[model samples]
Target: MTATGLTPSTQGAPDPASQAAARPTAHHPARAPGRLARSVRRNLTAHGFLIGAVVCFALFSWYPMVREFLLAFQKTERGRTTWVGLDNLTTVVNDPAFWQAWRNTLLFTALALVLGFAVPFVTALVINEFRHGQGYLRLLVYLPVMLPPVASVLLFKYLYDPGYGLLNELLRLLHLPEQQWLQDPDLAMLSVVVAATWMNMGGATLIYLAALQGIPGELYEAAELDGAGLLRKIWHVTIPQTRLILTLMLLMQVIATMQVFVEPFLLTGGAGPEGSTTTVVHLIYQYAFSFNNYGAAAALGLLLLVLLAGFSAAYVRLSRTEEA
Candidate 1:
């Protein structure tokens, strides 16, 4: 009411604090359609890739494996499938031919392991010891791996011809008996083993050579400085250094050789003169294709898968133990 306390114009006007509080807030545009469109596009992009990958794997790998597994319990008669349970497995196990095929596969694996395993390792070491022409030597050793198995098997078949083969001629020149390379029941497996070793050794030879290249030259040099002879250096330094690769190769060779097919299929008429060279794979072929027993073939195939699994498990455990 007093003149000094307040004027009429000030009393009627709005407060400064009230005017500041009445200011407008910020506004951002929310275009629902644009946000929705972007979200859908990104979601579709991610899910499309995921679905495509799964479909590819299912079509190529998973579906075939499932069918094969199911076939183990099924029989196909003129394109009709019927459930047979464990009958196929039992029948296969009871067959004398099954046992013979197993024996041949095992023997072939042994022979192959001997030649396939040792020859490559020894050859790799010899190549590694030299300080020159390693590239050329490696190529030469791996050359056989590039050859088609059919060509090599057929070539060996002629080389193994009974009377006129190069093998017989060489034996005659040395005054040795001209034994049948693939005719006799006892020697048929050996002939297959020889051909297999020749055909397969090249890949392993190069693998061993690569493994050998990783070993330090210093170890061998130190051993030599310590008056170690060639054999001693090899025994001490070389063996231990390349032991892992060697073990892995041996397991792989055993698993692969157990499934021997091409050499016997092409060279020996699928089973040789008798069933002497009939491998497990060849036997499976006989059951599935020749005999038309899909169930039994599946049973044998599943059995082979189990055997290979065992070998693989053992190798993996051994490698883990080595690392530990």
Candidate 2:
């Protein structure tokens, strides 16, 4: 204490520890490494997860597609590769089988849409109505889809045999004339479509069944109140509700049927009678494997790609227009 003051005030003085705590320290330059390391680790982890898929797509899908495009313009002849320019395209277009293959592919797509699209929807509708055994019925329908494709095709071949096939036998028993199923040019494509529809329709049928189950029962009741019959109810409520799914399935069926090769190849020996079953894909197979002409095969494949792309674009445009 001073003589004139009771005590000296420490209120304005700063604490040494507090001042030191608040003081800014010099930059170490080491923290940058720590932050950079953390960023690198995070990026590495993310890329590690993505690398597998990237590699797989690069190896299997993208590489093959790019190779096919290259093969379209290049030719391998007598252990030498040479650029053929548009010669391969010209050759593919000029081939007599090319147009025939397109025609057959289109026909197959049309028939598949009718049978594959309609049969599944109808089957789903019928199955949806069953109050009992729906699960068992669905299982039965899906069983064929689970079968080995080769085995199914072989079984169909035997069943389609005109001489001793069960179908002809049934017709004969009914006093109907036995008809050649796959052997006749006129019926071979139809036979293939029927078999394909039977084999592949299970998944579509189940999808439609799910769609049907999602429909509001109140809508059906309202429809009934309006005096709408069964067909009218289907048209007014069911079909409209399921239109999107139907359109998707229709596009899927078209693509599947257009690329059809295994069924017709195994059923009617690739070319069918008089090349009636020679679809575009089958023709491509013949070009690549049978004739050992990769360039021609690629060219034909490119053509099919263009056609399908155009068809899909037109369909989407039309759908949007209708929606608008």
Over the stretch 1-324, how does candidate 1's per-residue lDDT look in tens digits?
A: 688767556766888888888877678977799899999999999999999999999999899778778888998788788998988899899988899899888998889888878988899888887898988988887878898887888789889998889999999999999988889898888888888888888888888888888989899889999999999998998889888887878888888888889888888887787788888898889898988888899898889988999989988987898799
lDDT tens digits by residue: candidate 2, 60-158 = 999988999899999999999999999999999999999999999999999998889999999999999999999999999999999988899989988
Per-candidate TM equals 0.82, 0.86
Q: Lowest summed-lDDT stretch of 10 residues in model 2?
A: 1-10
Quantify all predictions' global Cα lDDT against the true fold.
0.87, 0.92
Quote the lDDT for 130 in model 2.
Answer: 97
User: 212, model 2: CA deviation in Å?
Assistant: 1.4
How many pairs collide in each candidate, listed in order?
0, 0
Global Cα lDDT for candidate 1: 0.87
Checking candidate 2 for backbone clashes, the offending pairs are none
Q: Cα deviation of 158 in candidate 1 (Å)?
A: 1.6
